[model samples]
Target: MVTPEEIARVPKVLLHDHLDGGVRPETVADIAERTGHQLPVDDPAELGQWFADAATSGSLVRYLETFEHTVGVMQTHDDLVRVARECVEDLADDGVLYAEVRWAPEQHLREGLTLTDTVDAVREGFEQGVAEAARRGKVVHPRQILTAMRHQARSLEIAELAVSYRDRGVVGFDIAGAEAGYPPTRHLDAFEYLHRENAHFTIHAGEAFGLPSIWQAIQWCGADRLGHGVRIIDDVDTSDPDSPRLGRLAAYVRDKRIPLELCPSSNVQTGAAPSIAEHPIGTLAALGFRVTINTDNRLMSQTSMSREMSLLVDAFGYDLDDLRWFTVNAMKSSFLPFDERLALIQDAIKPGYAI
Candidate 1:
């Protein structure tokens, strides 16, 4: 049995966390007050509950509405630095050794700051957080994934921003927002540019929408990984856990070894899955899909990597080996350089999981 404390002690890798979505409740309250924004609740605990409740409305749009308050407070450069720094501190406290945090820089320009300013601010915060964690005898490595809003026309610009910051802390680019009407094809120019630049990128597909969204993301936009690809299970036939059948799409994904960034709790909150026990991640993992568990929005989901892993242990009887397998999968699928990933796996991950 893997105790919660043991799980926390195990070095973890996160590939699909959102910067805006994981802001701490107290930080949100502080920023709200500082920025003169109104929150539904002033108390940190109540504000946290309000976000969790609002996200559970079972609509992707409704789930995203909760970000308005968080993002509203996150307009200033100081705010961005603070949030990014705390993001690292919080993840380090939870024993996350590496994480790729994604957020749309375009969204943070409302306070008269340029996209570069916001990105620089976040980078500064990440560095400060890393130094702070080191002082506390904890180490965390975090990289940024610049996201382009699917409903906006700034994907090409954002893609350029990501490339410009490639030598900095930016590791990848992403397209995020509602997945229904705004397909990945809409941002063909950006994807094509990223492909030409040999830049890594992931697509936000197969979460709110179905096969078409996923199909276009993979076959059309050429995503390195699928974000919240819970809907991929729709194409999988699991009449037998031992020998399940995969549809053409699912088979293609598995055969190609494309990573599926699966967020179980956030999936439930968005009605992607009914509950953790019924999530497709277990079946997909059992079937040898390249699945990586994640907490899409920690604040909204009220979760961490440890909580997510513990929930899986309770639901599916996964042992330490299973947890290690998931952690390695995430590390393998991360946008970090091959050498860094290998170093973390060999030095941190394997040693931590050793009996």
Candidate 2:
């Protein structure tokens, strides 16, 4: 059995995490104060609780409302830098040895920072943060996945920017936003450009929407992975008390090996899952779909990798084998180079289990 303490000490890889959504409230308050941005709530604890309450209320509209404040606080170069650095530190402390953080650069251009400047600022912070972690003997490495909002245009430009920065810590591309009515096909040209350039990207789908969204993200837009993808369960059936199995869509996703970044707490908060006990992650993992656990919005979900693992431990009674499979799934789905992925599995993950 994988004890909660053992799970915390297990080296993990995170493939689906949102940079803006993960910001600590204390960081948000400091940025709000320095930039004179009026936040609805000033106290970090209160603000954090507000987000937790709003997101977990089971309404997608209410859940998204929490981000308007986080986006506001992230409008300046300094704001971007601080959040990016702190995010790396926090992930490192949570036992994530590697993570790919994504956010839309165009959304942060309100306060005089150009699109390029915003991307660079975040990348600069990532570099500085990784160095600082190394100084403290932490083996955390992070990569950026530049995103372009699905509703707004400029995805192609962001796609090009991501490819350009492939040498400078940027690893891939992504598109995030409200899923309903904003199909990833709206960004086909951008994905086509990324495909032509041999760059990697993932799309937010099967979240706050249904199977059609997942279909468009995979078949139409060519996402290498599916973000949230909880609604894929809609296509499957568990009506039977025993031997519940995948539907066509679920089978195809598993057969094709499309990585599903499953955020249990976030899914519960957004009503994608009824609760941790009902989350499909355990079932999907057991069924051999490439399921990777993540903290979609740590602050809003009031979760970390440790908490997510702990919930699985208690709810699903998963053991170390389950944890190893989840870690391997995340590592394989990561846009990091193949050699590095293998090295992490061999050096960090395997040795941790030997303890």
Candidate 3:
């Protein structure tokens, strides 16, 4: 049996965590108080529970409402830095060795900070957090993925920003928000720009929406990965458990080995999945799809990497090897260079999971 303690000790790689959605509730309350941003509850514990409860409303739109408070307090450079730093610290404590923390820079510009300033502040915070974690004997490598809101018109701008900072801390670009009306093809220019520049990007598709959204993301926009791609299960026929059939789109996704960033807890909270036990990850993984586990919103879902893995262990009876496979899948699908990715898998991930 794989214990939760064992899950916590193994190294993990995260590819779908949100910077704003993972803010510590205590930090949110403290910053909210100092910045004069009103929160529903002033106490940290109550605020945390409030976020968890509100996010469980079973609608993605309503689930996203919890972010207003977290993003509200993170207006200035200092607040951004603090939140980003604590994000790394929390991930490190949860045994995450490498992560790509994403946020929309445009949303943080309300406090007179430019997109460039937001990127720089987050980079500085990541550096500080890495150093602090190292001092405590925890080594973590954190990178940035600049996201543009799908409802907004600044994806091209955010893509350019991500490319400009490629040599720094930024690793990729993404577009996230309500995925219903705002299809991935809505930002074709940004995708084309990213492709031309040889940059990597992931699209948040097949979550709130269905196959049409995912098809546009891959077929039209050419995403390197699928965020919350749980809906790809729609294209798969599981009537015959002995031999399931895959549709064209599903087979193409699997044949090309496009990674699916699956967040079980967050998906259930947002009604993307009925429950962790019924998540598509088990079916997808069994069928040899490149599926990676993630925590979409740590605060809203009240989850960690260890918790996510533990849930899978209970639901699907996955063992250490299964956990290592998921970790390697995430590392391979990361935006890091091939050599660095291989090095982490060899030096850190493999050794950590070794019996």
Candidate 4:
């Protein structure tokens, strides 16, 4: 019977946050003015609501257009530095101890910035924020994940960029954007390159799309993890609420222990799952899939790690053990080296849960 307050204070790790998607509205407005980019809304709260409305608008194209506004402001080095710094503060404030911010460098080159410059700017911000958090008495570590758009043709390039920045706070690589039509197979060359380089990446699948996307990402592209893998629940037959039947995909995900980055609020916002209560997380977790809760977009979904945990506590009556499972799931699924991850679980996570 852990209280929500207790859960909020517990340390957490995030695996599926988008750098552009999580930009605060006020930051967006300030950077837009500096970069001569006019945002659709000027008021921060209104703009926040506007982004959320558009993201949940049910049209993929329209939903994607929202990023145009976010990415528009994040063109310059200052913009990246500020956004990354604020992102660290926000995540630390929400009790996130470690997080990976993913964004495509290709999208931020509109104002004549190179891939290296962008990464450098973001790293600087992360470093600054880390120092600021220390002064604020919050201990947290933030890292970057370079994302390559699946529809576009620069995944291999992005993969190389990620490898180059590994020593500079870059943790891994990912392929995102328009999961419905753009399959990961289209980026097989990039995946193969990453695989050869011994790099880690997660593919956006099993959310807006279904089993085929997940299969192609893992069976075809060799993804180490699946982002927003909410739709993997589709493979389960729950005709009787008392008993559920796990289909081939669900069984494989379960038996193979494929980590599913489950963003509950974002899933409902995108119509991937009808509601949090209807979300298959509890069932899937009970059945033993390595499921990790995440904030797909803090601005778009108006969510945080605490909010996500609160919802799970409300919907499923999940106790401390359940929270431990979720946290351990994320720690295990992280792209960090095996030894480091084991230490976090054995030291930080286990000790934190002892309270």
Candidate 5:
């Protein structure tokens, strides 16, 4: 059995981490205190547990409500920088070699910062964090994924913003929010624009909803990846475990090598799955689907890349090889350039796992 410490030492790549969702509770309290914002609790530790507890309510809507406090405190440029920097440092400490940290810039405009300003601040923070981590003998490469709220109508603008910042720290674009009423086709124009620009993007689908949402994301929106695609298991008929049948959509996803960004803990917290042991990742991985592990929301789920991997280790009897497979899957699925991705796989990830 691989211990948690051993898992922490492995090189990992994260694809679906949210910037605001992973804010440090202490930082939230500090920013709140400085900016005269009210928090549910004053103690950082308690506030942290409060987020976890509130998100554990087993509804995606309720789980997302916890972001209000984190987003509330991140309206300022310095606060955004701090949160972004801390996110990088924390991931570095957990041995994440590459991560695409995503957040909706529209959500941070309450404090008078323009969309471009928010992106610049976050880029500055990432650069600082990278330098600091290197000083500590840990190398981490963090990229930005600009997300537009699907419930809102700013996807086209966000897509433009992502394309504008592509040469900068930003690597891709995405849309996130409650998935039921707001279909991905609502943002079809943005996806079309992204495709025209030859830019990469992902869509949040098959999490709170079902196959229809996944179909819309892939067929209608042409998402390069599916965020929280835990619900794709709905298309897999596992009645005969020995010969599980993949429906058309499931077969297409597997045949096309579509990457499923699966967050086991977050899926359970959102009632998408019963528990880690029962998560669709086990079946999906066994079926040879391109499944990558992630910490969807670190603070809300109270998890890290290491914790997620460890949970899988316990639930699926996954050892270093399994963990390496997940890590490689994530790296291969990342929006990073081809040469850079290959270099990391050859130099960093493989060497770390071989240890």
Candidate 6:
């Protein structure tokens, strides 16, 4: 059995975490008061519980409504920086050594900051958080992934912004929103542009939707990964262990080595998967798909990388080796340069698990 303490000490890599979705409850309260945004609950603890409860609506769109308050408070340059800084600190405290925190810059323009300024502000915050973590004898290498809202028209513009900041702390790009109606094909131009620039990106597909979403994300848009690709299980026939078979889409995902960023708690909260035990991640992992676990929305899901792993351990009986495998898969699938990814796995992740 993998103890919670051991899981806490294990170095992990996170590929699909949201920036606005992981703000500290106390910080949300403070920002709400300072920014004049009224939250449902005044106390930080109750506010956090409110978010977790509100997200339990079992609809992805409804679950996202909880972000209104969090995003409402995050409008100014200072607010963005503070949220970004705290994101790193919180993930570092949870034993995440490497994380890609994603958000939509266009959403933060309410206070008049330009998209470029928003990315720059977040970069500064990440640097500050890294320094602070180092001072506290922890090492967390954080990267940013600029996400374009799929239901909106700013994807091409957001894609351009992401490519412009590639050499900086920005590592990759993504499209996130209600995945059912707004398919990845809606932003074909953005994905094409990203491909032409050799930029990496992931699409939020096969979560609230089904195989068609996953197919388009891979076949049409050329996504490097599938965010919450839990719905890929729909195409998998696992009734018989001896005769298990995968549909064409699932086979392609596994044979092509595409990474599936599976967020178990968020999947349950959004009704993508029934429960941790029934999550497709177990089947995908057993059958050799490059499955990586993530915390899609920490506040809404009320989870961390540790908690996600712990849930899987409790449900699937995964040991340290399984945890290490998922961490390495996430590190390998990360948009970081290959050399850096290799070093983190060899020097950091492997050693941490060896303990």
Q: CA lDDT of each candidate?
A: 0.94, 0.88, 0.95, 0.88, 0.95, 0.93
Query: 327, model 6: CA deviation in Å?
Result: 0.5
TM per candidate: 0.99, 0.97, 0.99, 0.97, 0.99, 0.99
Q: List the RMSD of every prediction in angstroms.
A: 0.8, 1.3, 0.6, 1.3, 0.6, 0.8
Selected candidate, larger lDDT, 2 vs 3 = 3
Give model 2's clash tally: 0
lDDT of 3 by residue, 299-345 (tens): 99999999999999999999999999999999999999999999999
Give the per-residue lDDT of model 2 (tens digit) for 1-355. 6777888788888988889899999998988898788887899999899889888788877888888889999988888898999899888888898999998898898988988899899988887788888888787889999988888888999999999999888899988888777889988999999999999998889988999999888888888999989888887788874787778888999999999989999998888899899898877877788899999888898889989988998999888877888888899899988998889889888787675
lDDT of 2 at 284: 80
* Candidate 5 colliding pairs: none
What 10-residue stretch in candidate 6 is worst by lDDT?
235-244
Per-residue lDDT tens digits for candidate 1, residues 42-127, read 99999999999999988999999999998898899999999999999999999999999999999999989999999999999999
Question: Which has the better lDDT: candidate 1, or candidate 3?
Answer: 3
* Model 2 residue 199 distance off true place after TM-score fit, in angstroms: 1.0
Please say which candidate is ahead in TM-score: 1 or 4. 1
Better of 4 and 5 by TM-score: 5
Which parts of model 6 have CA positions greater than 4 angstroms off? none
